[model samples]
Target: MNRTLVRLLQAPSIILLLLWMIIPLSMTIYFSTIRYNLLYPERSGFIGLDNYRFFWTDPSFFPALTNTLVLVGSVLLITVVLGLAISILIDRPFKGRGIARVMLISPFFIMPTVSALVWKNMLMDPNNGLFAAFANALGMQPIEWLQDMPLFSIIIMVSWQWTPFAILIFMTSLQSQDKEQQEAATLDGAGFWSQFYNLTLPHLARPISIVILIQMIFHLAVFAEIFVTTSGGPGVQSTNLTYLIYIQSQQAFDVGVASAGGVFAIILANIVAIFLIRAVGKTLTV
Candidate 1:
């Protein structure tokens, strides 16, 4: 009787969660199967896989796909590596460590749109931005970051914002580490690199996997940074899959193609998630 009552209590939330996810997914699948352009509703009809074919054939599709992969990969690499280094450096006791940690982690709290705008106008602006000012002081040319390297610029912004998340996770994990093992290593004359490789790295493996898994999921859908900073431009050079779908839906007014792109993105996300989950599981088992 108690178990039955508990299940009854849980049913509403479970059903609501299902409906929340299922409704939008069902609508997207239905839209992908038909020609339902808002601009041409009169021409709406069942089109089967025609929408998918159109989306796949779009000239920007491959470039958008490549950019998405590159952005996710680069951001993951940067965040995990830099986050680990920063966490380790700050893990030791120091003067003003609390203040340093707050400053380092503060970037993650900023909204992505605001972060992008700051990077665009305050940091990356060629003629009058900080980079240009630094270059002028150094007697060097200030390269146009967004115009010359839009995708890389986006990667930098995302890395700056997300590295703090990785730092938080790693620092927390490091706190739980066995200090006895470190003292033993030190007594045995193990140098910093040796101790890090033998003790710290192994201790951090699970946290590293977790950080990668979570970051990859969010990185795959990075749209606001690109939208706010470069607008996926210099001619689609910085456009990822999410931004590509936006271009189809908003710019071209092609609901069917955008829906098809959305479906494709869902599939890609699922595939990546499965692989990451398996990797994380292996780390946990080890």
Candidate 2:
């Protein structure tokens, strides 16, 4: 009776959630099948899979897809490695540990737009930015970041923002670790590297998988940073799948194409999610 009542109370929220997802998805699918254009709204008609074909064949499509993969992969690698290092460093008691942890995790709380802007104007400006000043002080030329290395700059900015998230997760996982096992390893003449390789790494497998799965989903839709810093330029160098869809919708006013791109993105995200979930599930079980 209690379980039944609890489920009854949850039904409204479940229904609302379904409707919330289903409505927009239904609309997008409908739009994807039609020749919908914001500028030529009167000429709208059913176009079948033409939008998908065009979007798939688009000149920018492959580059955007490649960029998306590179960004997500690079950011994940950097965050996981850096987060693990930072978490291990601060896992044990240290001077001002609380203050240091708070400072390190603070970046995760900053708004993406603000973070992008700060990186753009303050650090990667290439003219009067901090990096440029440091380069000049060292008698080295300041390279144009956004212009010369647009995608790398985006990767760096995003990695900075997300590393803190990984750190937080790893730190939490570390707290639940078995201290006695570590003590036993130490008494058995196990060195730091041996203990870390055998014990610490094994203990962190689940958290690392969790972080990768969550970050991968968000990384697929990285937009604001690209929009703010590079506008997917110079010449689509940093344009990912999300920004490519934005260009189709907002810049070209092609609603059908944009909706088709959205559907493609959704499919890609679902595929990644499935693979990651299964892999992580297996790791957790083992």
Give the winner by TM-score: 1
Assess candidate 2 and give its TM-score to the true structure.
0.94
Tens-place lDDT per residue, model 2, 127-148, is 9899999999999999899999
User: Which 10-residue window of candidate 1 scores lowest in summed lDDT?
Assistant: 277-286
Q: What lDDT is obtained when candidate 2 is compared to the true structure?
A: 0.96
Candidate 2 segments whose C-alpha is farther than 4 A from its true place: 1-8, 275-286
The digit string of per-residue lDDT tens for model 1 on 90-200 reads 998899999999999999999999999999999999998999999989999998999999999999999999999999999999999999989999999999999999999
Quote each prediction's TM-score. Answer: 0.95, 0.94
lDDT of 1: 0.94
